[model samples]
Target: MDKQLSPVELRHQIRSGEFSDQTSGLCPGYTQANLVILPKADAYDFLLFAQRNPKPCPILEVTDLGSKNLHTFASDVDIASDFPKYRVFKNGELVAEPTDVNDIWRDDLVSFLIGCSFSFEASLITAGIEVRHITAGTNVPMYNTNIPTKAAGKFHGNYVVSMRPIPQNQVVKAVTITERLPQVHGTPIQIDHPETIGITDINHPDYGDAVEIKDGEVPVFWACGVTPQAAIMASKPEFVITHAPGHMLVTDVKDVDLSDIL
Candidate 1:
């Protein structure tokens, strides 16, 4: 797929079964969202979970109960099918990795569109920082961390973070750029300390692919929206749907307007 496709165009491609790959480095300048869909019975708990854990779960849009439509982020969105990929979990175990969820749609489902670190990469690139995964043409490396999240109702788990190898000299610039976009996981949570966060093997991440930590580069970690999936795994929700790691929903909202909308 062309990296320059408009958000709606990309969604159309995804919806039509034409584009079913990770969304990183696509739709530059626009926002990409991490998805979480749960039954209405579990909506409030997840909502509370997100509120208690803002950094990893900054919410962009929450679809109305039972509705697949969105209001703030995109006009041509179908919560059931727009994302590049979807993971269905049953009792916390992954059951399927389908490109669309229309086959399993339920009226009682509630969708949460969480802010994604991918949304801020455009800024990082514009500032001359090399996003290693993008350069390597691979999914951003994400690791399960020892950093625990605040418990909210039945939703509770440790944080999941995405890693980027930032040049030592440009770490501050990368931080400064992302800090302005808190809705998209604002700043680095850990720098050059994977062991400090319970990650024994940075070379073998829990999600996505690991990239090289070059000579002058330090692995910078950012809170990731995949935190919910970790929570689902630990908390053992009966059923849940999520965008596969790195496979996100390209939203109509632009990264620049994120702060104002929130």
Candidate 2:
């Protein structure tokens, strides 16, 4: 787990099963992605869902039907194995959490690469703001909120958000920095008040680990890419695969270049 490894190197390590942990602070300066794989039958609906709800499920690159190779985001990409961890669902039930999905690969599966908050974390750190989870060596805390997403086909559910506690004085700076990268869920959706967004228990998250919120800091919430998983649970799609919460795909694209996506 050398933090200095290049994106390609880190991905290769993941592909080889040498790295099977969450991808948070790794591959700094480069972009990271959230993954969603579905049978061709469900692809169109999910696409529509993402299009309608861009903040949480920003589309970075979607692979061709039945193909796992990616060209827009990374060269030499193997979609099935590039991500650190994968969650497989069957009829909306989580059936497996595998390091690689090659064994269960299907010719009709489509891969959707969604923008991730980790992509913008480096910029936040550069702005002199601390990303608590990264510094604490844990995954960012995520919560299921009462915020409803714009329904699209069978994908309609509440928005899932990742929380990062920002210092009181620097909250606006964090917002200004992230607002520039809309592709990766830009800006804080809810600030300082978790209960307003249906998050009753800040200490216990539905996904990932919780971190301390210092006296001078406030909990900031950003739309998370994992919202689709909640949709799966709500709609019960027969088969779908996603990156395990906090686990992500490290892409070759740089964070500074993400504005071009807008």
Candidate with top lDDT is 2
Residue 3 lDDT, candidate 1, scale 0-100: 79
RMSD of each: 1.9, 1.9
Summarize candidate 1's per-residue lDDT along 1-262 as a digit string, tens digits.
5777899999999999898887766888888888889999999998998899899989888999889999898997898889878999999899999998998999999999888777688889888898888888888889989999999989888999999999899999988999998998899899888899998998999888989998988899999877876786788889999988778888888888888899
Clashes of each: 0, 1
Q: What is the TM-score of each candidate against the true structure?
A: 0.91, 0.92
Per-candidate local distance difference test: 0.88, 0.89
Q: What does candidate 2's lDDT look like per residue over 1-262, in tens digits?
A: 6999999999889998899998777878888888889999989999999999999989999999889898778997899999888999988889999999999999999999988777678789888999999899887899999999999988899999999999999999999999988998988899988999999999999998999999999999999978976886788888889998778988888888877754
Q: Model 2, stretches more than 4 Å misplaced?
A: none
Q: Any runs in candidate 1 off by more than 4 Å, and if so which?
A: 2-4
